[model samples]
Target: MSTKKHKVLVANRGEIAIRIIQACVSLGLDFVCVYTRADEASGHLALARSLGGPNAAYRVSSYHDANEILAVADHAGATAVHPGYGFFAEDFRFARRVAERERSLIFIGPSWRIIRSLGDKINTKRLARSLSIPTVPGSDRPVYDELEAEEIAETLFAFQAEQGISNSVVLVKASAGGGGMGIEEIYDIEQFKTVYRRIRNYAKRQFHDEGVLIEQRIFDFNHLEVQIVADRTGTGIVHFGTRNCTIQSTGRQKRVEIAPGFRPQEVDYAFDAEKLMEDIVGYSLAMAREVGYDNVGTWEWIVSPTGQPFLMEVNTRIQVENGVSAAISRVRGQGGVNIIAEQIRLGLGEPMGYDQSNITFDGVGIEYRIIAEDPANRFTPWVGRIDQFLAPTLPYASLHTHIPMDEPYEIPTEYDPNLALAIVWGKDLAEAKKRGVDYLDELTLSGADGTGTELKSNVRFLRDKTSTILQF
Candidate 1:
């Protein structure tokens, strides 16, 4: 067992695994990756070894089970495990098990305690309030039934000060949901009844939590968020700047995400874009210091029309835009990704080569998630193997995808179709958007080719029609 080279089990698939594997290589560490029955020939596995050294090992098996991954990590004598967002990335129980594994397999990212705390939207709201961060106006606890929700909403309407509501529509949301699941917009009791039942059933089936929360939804608002990183020693705290994701639809099934959305022509961010970025970074840093936050975390927020910034939620893992944001950080001379690596090093009590001041982000980068669903057909998700895949190459942009080249990419219906991420970076946001359009135009697939040519055509058509420039 070579103590000098850390052996890390990459308990994830897709572009994220490739990203982490690259980081491991940069640190001169040994790489280990696992795949499911469906992903035995995934690009993630191939890329992991292609970038790894001869000493590096790759395993293809059923890592579909959390316990299964743990057993493999234990048997492989892995020193640490990195869950690269998605799959079991935010699973608190999985994190706990990884930590409990013998031979000291450090679980990358925040402690299991923090994951659980942030996983529950109610608990996160309470914590945000305690820290003086304005969270979405909602009940401090979960709502049990329609009657309970109606009472809460009516009370809020009457008091007007309870949830800052002066007879306005509110969003009924599930405490445990991501990717826009278990949510509905309601105005009256009838609407509430219709939406709540559907949402409650979805929540119970998805998260086993029938309890939901009612929050004041911001309409026609520009969405802004800050990405923060905290070190284990509680010494280094940094923010990687802000991203505007305003382009959205009120649709329940599918919503469009435009990164670096056009500057709000009407309303500005709750805080000065630059100031809010720093403040959010500062607030999260202070909170992490108090609570001993470790690894990567993001303080999600939305800026209202009145320029009041409200904390929406906190994600205790590498967020969906992590790679894109990392590109931004590197261009700005900030160490977003480096900080995470340093935190991992410090948690292990190992000397790290992290110079917070020296790290820089080089260009504006945008990533568009290409899902395996038809955008025109109510965004119906297409499952099964992808028979063919033809990726695009943009100017100064590279594709980090899961679709295997020259082979059938077997995609299961069990998980989400993060088929590929079209990552494009430019000298600025404008160039990134142009590249994104071009990249979207060029992506191709077969049976499970992710939203197919028609999807790309619609996106491009809309981009041209809107003449509206946004980079994601």
Candidate 2:
């Protein structure tokens, strides 16, 4: 319970690492950060060194190497490990090791058991169904048997047909696959078997598991998430609200996220937006309490075009979009809520001093994940040198980036070139959109690849999506 004695080792890199360091500082705690050779120029390492005193940043061979991470943690005398999204963020085994090791370090996330239980999409669906929580209409478990898989596919197609959904589509994906891998869509029931076999084969070859998940792919659904935070005891669970993550790349990677999920006052929707948001928040809290979720987590939900909200899965770690939710959230009539700091504090065995009623939301907040990628080319990674990276100087807007602004930074090819996160807030949704576009317009981000090719980014794509956000 004594957080001051804790020295956290940030087991990840990039802007998230910086966020974790800052969160630790805000909590009056020491911290260490690690990076690979390719990430030497990252701002996270620089900030950690500047703020974390001597030997704050450690050089590692690979971020995914648990032994290296643990060694660094031991060398730096770290008492806790914060896997800031990606890498070992959702890996239950990693979390377990951080807890069960002889010289254990606190895992700054949900417990290992909770991560393992909720990490399985199929298991999460079953849990939701048991609680009468709505999940996407699909087979809960892996359809390993061909006959059984085809029957589930036919039933899904028939169910969609009865719902008056046109151009019916069924998703056949490796149940064990993740990050949009080993998945394909089938429009024809006859073609379902072929696609299923191909995916099953791909799953076996790739994941060594031929388990396939068949589900009705609901078109025009908005990808939403509920941000849940709990105390170390899991007895206190409060929500920071929901986010609209429908603006994504063709690869299903999120590019833009907005808090509050929907704005029924500004844009009209098919279903009751406020009611839907409340329902998702309630369901998320219910599940979190059910599992004794003792830290920060995100409950992803997909709402169909007709307004049915279905639980997608649970992220047992702090999410990248968490900052957007914090931007608009206020507690005890005070603003400037830093969710990362809250997660660190709560993860380090802190008590939830305040109740849900003490927390209040202010204005609309929009977060733009500015990355060096060609959105026109299916979001191809744009690797090059960043020459001039300028951020907007607006009071309502804040940006987080690992690429330094004073000097040219070569966008490392070994990792994703996510340049920055531009978060803009406004008193209302319309104002937020205006400020978001203005922030993008004012942003001076220019770079070139090795061949002198101009950097292609999702700035334009993000700008365009600002006008149509939450309009489902």
Model 2 over residues 244-278: C-alpha lDDT tens digits?
Answer: 99998887888899998998888999888899999
| Candidate 1 weakest ten by summed lDDT | 253-262
lDDT of each: 0.65, 0.91
For each candidate, give its TM-score against the true structure.
0.83, 0.95
Error of 1 at 399 (Å): 1.3
Worst 10 residues of 2 by lDDT: 175-184
Model 1 scores a TM of: 0.83
Error of 1 at 429 (Å): 2.8
* lDDT of model 2 at position 154: 92
Determine the backbone clash count of candidate 2: 0
Cα lDDT tens digits, model 1, 159-244, are: 55465665567788887776577778777655777788888998999889888888776755656666666666555655565665
* RMSD in order of candidates: 4.2, 1.9
Q: Using alpha carbons, what is the TM-score of model 2?
A: 0.95
